[model samples]
Target: MPRSIRYFVAPAAMALSMCATAVVAQSFSSSTFEIPKPERQTFVPAGTSCGSIVLTQSTSQSITAANSVSCNAGGLHSDNSYFRSFPLAADINVCEVQFGIETATGASGTQPVTVNLYSGTGAFPGTFPGSYTQIGTASLNVPDQAATIFPATVSGLATAGSNLVVEVFTPDGQTAGNSFFIGSNASGESAPSYLQAADCGVTSPATTGSIGFPGMNIVMNVVGNPGGPSLSVGSAQATLVDQCASNPGQANGVIEPGETVTVQVPISAAGGSFTGVVATLGIPAPAGITYVNSTSNIGSLADGNSATATFTVTADAGATCVTGFSLPINVTSNEGATASGSVASQIGESG
Candidate 1:
């Protein structure tokens, strides 16, 4: 039997709570990947036109712990089409879908991603009902795992439980098409960021990036004159990797030189409890970025005022249940900087 690994992430303590003991919050993680070997194989009825979408199971085997299932909703690379779908349940508290998709490998740019869940039956495949709730929509510029969540109030969702289909669509409707599969039971581990952006003056353009050192997508947009200046960006680059040292790992990216730019980088997790050695690099402006919490700030550079974002990968690995990970980000620039962002992860497991 393959070795089973569980992940756990610890929460930070409040500064004023020095006399109080730190509290560790239990977070859960989940994966949206292709199943090694999917059983109960069921294909869409003829003429249903799954389009470029497909469902796959990893290797047909038993995983001691929950893993990830892959979704090929996005079409093949040559075609550039994408796919998405949702779980068949009503009054859904929380719904998540995970999968690996095309991203910035060398420099083909990144694939733009859009995820949606609709209410549909066997007969009406083309015409979906409801508001086509947007669980996650991103312009992924890298190739990695994609995971997103949708709240219960998604428009057009079935109030009652029934056999419903979930669909993932490519934003531009590229010819290569797109593909997205479900994550393994082990995947859906945690909820990284759930705070509103307006309050912080920053927001995740899309959903939080994936786990481990997959890559990071971030947007730091600011408007009008608050206590600070405004800023925006078109695009940028970021990356993450595992060092296997006493620290968890590290990652960084380049922020294009401009009043505003969009940045994308890789993020990762090694499926076990490992201290993460993290850092932020190539920050064009220090005055524009601020750390929400001083405790989470690990390192910084003074010369160019360029700072490195740092945090720990809470100890969740080597446990009995799933673990979760997340890195919150905030950006500030002179007015006119509309920052949009997204993130992804490269999940690693132990045997």
Candidate 2:
């Protein structure tokens, strides 16, 4: 899992008639923590249609943690095509697609990136050649800019689920391994980025993770309309992590004093952009439960858009344990107007 930006509040002393003696609030994270890089990748096939994922990564995979300079894709001297699957809920006519560039490698000039999109039935890799049918293709030259978006033209109507498969490559226009690299971040994309090429050792659909880079993702994003994209809940299944770490007694699958509960809310904003995105638990914690970190900053949403707001809830000694708890959360963004939605999570049974 990835780390979230946290805000910690100090413990304050409140006299419970000056008699209770000791009791305090606390703070915690979903886990240790790393920059949350969210991305969307489906599957990549052989050939150089769109820009291939960089082969010989400039930055070592060993150092590919969040904020690592070495992009999950992009290599020092490898030529390969990169691909990812996007499953959006709206019906869209993709007019263009953007391939984020991390580094131009050694592209003094003449680094051409050809991108393509395929409409497919069934799931990717699982369906492969039989599922994906070419939609359209576009190309662009790699710019000198260090980090930015390079776009390609692709036309198609994407539906829900396994809608579209995107591809990028460095055809014959530029040196195979000496062109540019695709940009990626630790924002937390659900799909996997796929690559294809001989120099990269992958002749077919293989994840950057499979080849060594575990969490590498090519920021292959979409720019389409017709059915203008919107942001909504993708997955809101909130649960507890390391119950023992927060739980005071036996991990009896029930909410007990000192137990830490994690509420992870994942949202996908394919073509929807939201600002000042924030998430908070809608329902107040039952008696004895302290919402250590109740709200999380989702920040902004854009082309390569997705975010997971993780909140921490704890059960104090005074908590009232009952049946499993159902937590409702609200995700709101101010886009000129306030747009918000509520989601419920079955965190745990109150003991």
Candidate 3:
């Protein structure tokens, strides 16, 4: 059996109180706590794409006239095709992609941009055959004469230990001398940028260049789950009983000295499945509270499943002076994931 581990931090302690029966006035309150979710990983090489030399001409015009003529042909410019290669630390489902681009003042236009993710083979500018998959594309509107980020949504799976290639295609060729450029970082750190121009074309052996200086401003958003199961606490309830004869008719939130409080917490599991769940209560001895039953077994939970645990607390006859108190509850899974939550209430003393 594969071993898994999960860690959860329960919410802050809830307030509960036990006082004389004479103190019948009290109020109940509820608040929610946030559970940590799996974090998204981002890849950003050291560089910016503003003010870098033009690499490939995305427009359809020939490479020589690409800079002079606006290849407004409305498709990938044979002159400018760009790609970046990087490695994945773990298996991830890619969710988003962003690119930095520059446009001349008053050169606003909308075009559909295509992005592809490929499994790499060989070297830096790996051989991207027809086997590559077209993840998704976005229709972006460029702002004239300004530096802006173009964001797109793409979905694909990249396995760990594989070199991933991200390719970007520009829409339509632009008019001659009309300036539009892809951003790049000057530092060729991390992934090397490759260019396939009309002159060199994608078919010719690709040449490595730092065109979009700092390197191309490309970002990849990856969705992945942290190891093990994830756990969280839901709504909680407790039974209140006044053991002290002095506080006979106290409300749910109020208890007299020698009263007993029973708390029930709801637990849930997400992200993965696990077995042997247990819940325990942690009360400070100095708080004048005793745990009648400190632990409960929850058994097993499949992913997206839920269960509840109950605990009993008794107030010491001599427990006094404190108007309110709190206790910590911890829930653990045999697989190693743990979650915590608390219950609390206010107390008033009666004559």
Candidate 4:
């Protein structure tokens, strides 16, 4: 089955340089921002032609720009800006790039300039993706813009596993040169299906506002009984959640004909305060399965206990924080055995 992919934010500029690779190396002479804006010339001029969006595992491939410029220690400028689309293979999740300045012409002065990189689901943006949209940026000063080298990486960006779009733009009104593929390279990542997370529910008195920091309570009563089978992971981890901070996100426990256990996941309000809390079930899942009550549907845990995944908001004193939230229940076997939906009270506030 085709799997869903997840992305992680890459490290800032310096961290990437420490571990540069020759295989996935750069091609442009310089990736610096240097072209001076003419009194009226647009950086990415009106009729400029953008490049193609292709899916490939190759880390580097030669590409041509619609228009080209000169070179400096920094590298090249884009009269012809380019965009490339690549599919992140199922076995990997991260992509990296180093910029070079080349094909230069005119001007030789250093200025603090910015470059923007954007990631989205489709073709390149006709206009630039918002300044707020770039996943990463770099700044440099050089004899000429193409003389400076800009290095950047894209990490933890989720992909449906195919046709993910990546584009580079000049932020200082200068245009970006065509980035050539250096090699078919990527950081190996575990398959998304194997990732899992575990957490116990929180049981607490509401104080006022948001409680339940990332880690506060013990995740009790794992859905499968004790001594159940263990989970496996490739590169990523299996993430679980304690949905109900003070209340359960799913039914409390299951009482069945064959195996029955009382599993409890408890939650507590932070030091006598009440605030809205967000307890996630897990990062979104791949296609083969989904999590319910923090357990795989194949079977119930030893104790028959379940967990919760939720997002709740709390108001200030007397602001009417959420009174309760609902739990979603599912039964893999008999349809009639399922429990009706349930709601529990919000931890009461003290202050």
- lDDT of every predicted structure (CA atoms): 0.25, 0.51, 0.45, 0.24
For candidate 2, write residues 72-137 as lDDT tens digits.
122333445778877655566564566666546444644666777777777777787687887656
lDDT of 1 by residue, 286-332 (tens): 33232222222222212112223332232223322222222333332
For lDDT, candidate 3 versus 4, the one ahead is: 3
* Candidate 4 per-residue lDDT over residues 229-323, each given as its tens digit: 11111101112222444545332332111211222222211111222222222344212223333442333222212223232222223323333
lDDT measured at residue 92 in model 1 versus the true structure, 0 to 100: 28
**Model 3 per-residue lDDT tens digits across residues 83-184:** 666565655444334554433232344434566656543454544654444433333334442233344433344556766566666533434323344543
Error of 3 at 299 (Å): 32
Q: Which ten residues in a row have the lowest lDDT in candidate 3?
A: 61-70
Q: Whole-model lDDT for model 1 versus the true structure?
A: 0.25
**How much does candidate 2 score in TM-score?**
0.42
Indicate the TM-score of model 4: 0.24
Better of 1 and 2 by lDDT: 2
Name the lDDT value of residue 340 in candidate 4. Answer: 17
Q: Which stretches of candidate 2 lie over 4 Å from their true place?
A: 1-78, 105-108, 160-162, 172-177, 227-351
- Runs off by more than 4 Å, candidate 4: 1-81, 91-95, 104-108, 111-115, 123-134, 142-150, 153-156, 171-351
